[model samples]
Each structure stands twice: as structure tokens, then as C-alpha cells.
Target: MLYVMILAIIVLVYVLTRLYFLKREIKRTTRQLNELNKNATAKKIDISYFDRDFEKLAKEINNQIDLTKKAKAEKRSTENELKQAISYISHDIRTPMTTILGYIQFLESDEITPEMRKEYISIVKNGARRLKILLEDFFELSIIEQADYPMKIEMIKLNQLILEVLLGFYEEFNKRNLEPTIKIPDNDIVLRADHSAVKRVIENLVVNAIRYSSGTVTIQLEEFNTSVQLTISNSVDQLSEQDLNHMFDRFYKADQTRTGKGTGLGLPIAKSLMGKMNGRLTAEQMENQLFMKCEWGN
Candidate 1:
């Protein structure tokens, strides 16, 4: 009986040890599974952060593209506005000009009084001339805005050409009771350019000087190695800075309401012609006078 009891106790001890080892293994496996879950969650968070950064970069790129598009749209809008304004002015001026011409032609008949005939004839001639100038300006402006206008260039004497233009205006200058003073080099100054276009530009400048000068108009010709400059200056009362800024803009009249007769296109046309010829036209105010300067290059 004693041997049987001892054997039973040993068996009990072995069973208890086996149960403790089984419980320890179960706890270790649970801890390993929890660590694996934590590692997987950390990797997911890193992927989420990368996704947010990528979205932010994409948004920035889209914003830049939108800004560029807006700028281009604004530029096109401004160009369209300029074209519309020119069209409106051209259409509005023609009707009045035609009526003035018709009346002048009617006054030439025998029904007009003899004493008033000369004065009527002068008025008609001036009106017709002014209308012609306006039409010419409209045509030239159209050509300048075109992309396919031809530029016929040649080598010509700039100095002699200027002198010829000034001589043509001699009678007008005398009639205005204004003295003409010129400063030119003794030798001929040659330039590679479109001669006809340059002649028109110089003529416009000189005529503008005559129209605006109170007493005297001065012209100077200066030659450089690669370019030539012609300056025409006329004395006038002080002009506002606003006039100086927009002197070459089309249909911009400084004294539009005043009695002085001008279509306000002479300087603008001259400036456009110069641009077509790859030259430049600019204006300056000095000593209470206005100066128009033209520069041509080889």
C-alpha cells in the first residue's frame, strides 16, 4: 500500500510541471502577435504621410499652371481692346469728313459771292486736305498692325532726304511767320532703310513742329557710326506729363477741345512707320518746348 501511494504523488508532480510550461508558451505567443500588429500599423502610417506630401506637391503644380493661363488670357484681352478702339474711331470720322468735302465742292459754283469766293475756296481746300490726311493715317495704321506687310529696304542718303523734306515745307513755314533753323553735317549721311517710309516720318515731324511752334522751329541731324538721328523741336507752353507719356498713342489729342486743327494721328503714324522700318521715334519736353526725335539704324 505504501509503494502505491508514493508512485501516485510523483505522477501528480510531473503533471503540474507540464501545465506550467504550457501556460508560459501561450503568453509568449500572445506577446509576439501583438508586436507584429504594432509594426504593421507603423508601416501604414508612413505610407499615409507620403500620400499627403504627394497631394500637396500636385496642388502646387496646378496652381502655377492656372496662374500662367490667366496671364496669357489678360494679354489677349488687352490686344482685342486696342483693335476694337481703332475700328470705332475709323468708322466715326469718315461721315463728317465726307460732308465737309461735299460742301466745299458746292461752294465752287457761280452762285457763291465773288468777295467770299476766295475765303470759301481756302476753307474747302483745307478741309479736303485734312480728310485726306485722316484716311492716309487709317490705312497706314492698318498696314502696321498686319503681320505680312513687306519691308523694302535700300541704302539712301538720309541727310539730303531730310533737306528735301524741309525745303518742301519752306512756304508753309514762311506763311506761319516762323523762322527755320537747321543743323546738318556737311557730308551726306547714308543709312540702310526704307527711304519712302523714312521720308514720311521726317515730314510728319517737321509739320508737327510747324503746327505747334510759337515763333521758330529748329531741326538737327546727327550721324553715328551705325545710326542717324533727326530732331525737330518747337517752342510751346509747358505740357503735362500725361501728354508726354501718351504722345505716340493713336487718337490721343492733347488739346482736343481747342480750336487748333489736328487729327491727332501725325506723331502716331510717324512712330508706326519708324517701327516698321526697324527704327524708333520718341518725344521729349525741354525748356517749355516739345521735341520729336527720329532714329534710324544700318
Candidate 2:
């Protein structure tokens, strides 16, 4: 009878011991969670225990925490980009509007000769055109970003498309006094892409090259086994490495002090369109020459 009683006591003691440890571990996990609430950082929970359930729970909790962190990071980045866009829009719009207003004031004055009045009228018209372009590009970028852009994907003959785009810019090229050297493959290099998007990208790159380049602009097209590359190179004035890095950033200027007459939306819009078409746009600066490359998968 006494041995039986002793055995019952031993069993009770074993159960009590396990219950105590289980409660302690639960409390520890709860405390960690409370601490996480206090501190903004939702760190992973670590606990040493002899159970697979606790380990699995900890891992799942860690995954959720990681997701939370990622969400926070994305939110912060979006907020920053929004702030940047607003500032750039204000500066870009105000500059041209101010120029137009000033030119109008000059036109109102009676002291100006006809030649001077004609020049001022031309400047005012140009300013108005620039403002219109700026607003159009801004809206286009928003449409591309919001996935509202309509695309018709088809087989594209790159050489022919590039030729057509360049020919359209003949007057601009002549105005800039730039003689572009064109090297395209004799054989057709075809890519499956959106025709309008491809054309827009080519046009943007050409416009950038002609506007910023001084003497010679070189445009080359190369085909790889699996991809095609269109590169436009030109000699630019005072283009730095930092400028190249942010060349695709909207409203970025190589020389911020200059306040260029360009809307600064060309490269950014090109980049966004390329991304939508599953292509890549990259740029590099060698010495004073800037090379803009667009790669499309065949």
C-alpha cells in the first residue's frame, strides 16, 4: 500500500514539473510579444524548448514579422517618391510659366522694335509648348505606373522602326548641328514588343542625344543570341557620374543650377515604358560621352 502511494506521488510530481515548464515558456513568448508592441521593430521571437510546435510557431511568427518590415519599407519609399514628385513638378512648371509671363510683359512694352517683339513672341510660344509637353509627360508616366497603359505586343523589326523614328527628328538634328553616325545590322533583328512603346523609347533617346550633344552622335544597334541592344552615344557638356546614375530619375538635371529648358521627363518616361514592355534601359558616361542603351529580349 505504501509503495502504491509513493508511485502516485512520483507521477504527480512529474506532471507538475512539466506543467510548470510549459507555463513558463508561454509566459516568455507573451512577454516577447508585449515587448515587440512597445518597440516599433517587430523582431523575431527566439525560444529554446523541447517541442516542434513551439519552433514552428516561432518560424511562422518570424515570417509575419518580416512581411511587416517589408510593408513598412515600401510605404516609406512610396511616401518619399510622392514628395519628390510634387517638388519637381512645382519647380518645372513655375520656371516655364514665369518665362512666359515675363515674355508677355516684354511684348506689352512699346519701346521694343519689331525684331525684338518677334523674338519675344517666339520665346513665349516655346515656353507654352514646353509647359504643354511637361503636363503630357507627367500624365503619361502616371498612366504607365498605374498599369492603365494599353499595349499591343507584336513582332517588331528594330532597324526599320529606328530609321523611321530618326527621320522624323531630321529637323531637330539639323537645328542642333549634330551629324549622327548610325550603325545597324544589315540583317533584321526582330523582337516581340509593343510597337508604340519601342518607338517612344527610341524617340526619347534620340531627342536626348540631339539636345545635349554638341558635335557627333553615334547610334548603334546590336543583336545577341537572345537579346537586342540599341545604344545611343554622344558628347555631352559637364555630365558627371552622379548624373548618369540618376539620368532616368524624373526631373533630374545634370546641372541643377542651369535650370534647363527641357521638361526632364523623356528619360524617365522611356524607362517606365521599357519596364512595362519587359525591356531594360541603362546608361553610362565615358569621359564626356553619354551612352544610353535599351535591351530587348528576343
Instruction: Name the candidate that leads on lDDT.
Output: 2
lDDT tens per residue, model 2, 49-165: 666887888888878878887999999988987788788889888888999999999999999999999999999998889889889999988888776678899998999999999
TM-scores of the candidates in the order shown: 0.67, 0.86
Superpose all Cα atoms of candidate 1 onto the true structure and report the RMSD in Å to 1 decimal.
Answer: 18.1
Report the error of model 2 at residue 288, Å.
4.1
| Model 2 regions lying over 4 Å from their true place | 1-22, 40-43, 109-113
Q: What is the lDDT of residue 66 in candidate 2?
A: 86
- TM-score winner: 2
Q: What is the lDDT of residue 30 in candidate 2?
A: 84
TM-score quality measure for candidate 2: 0.86
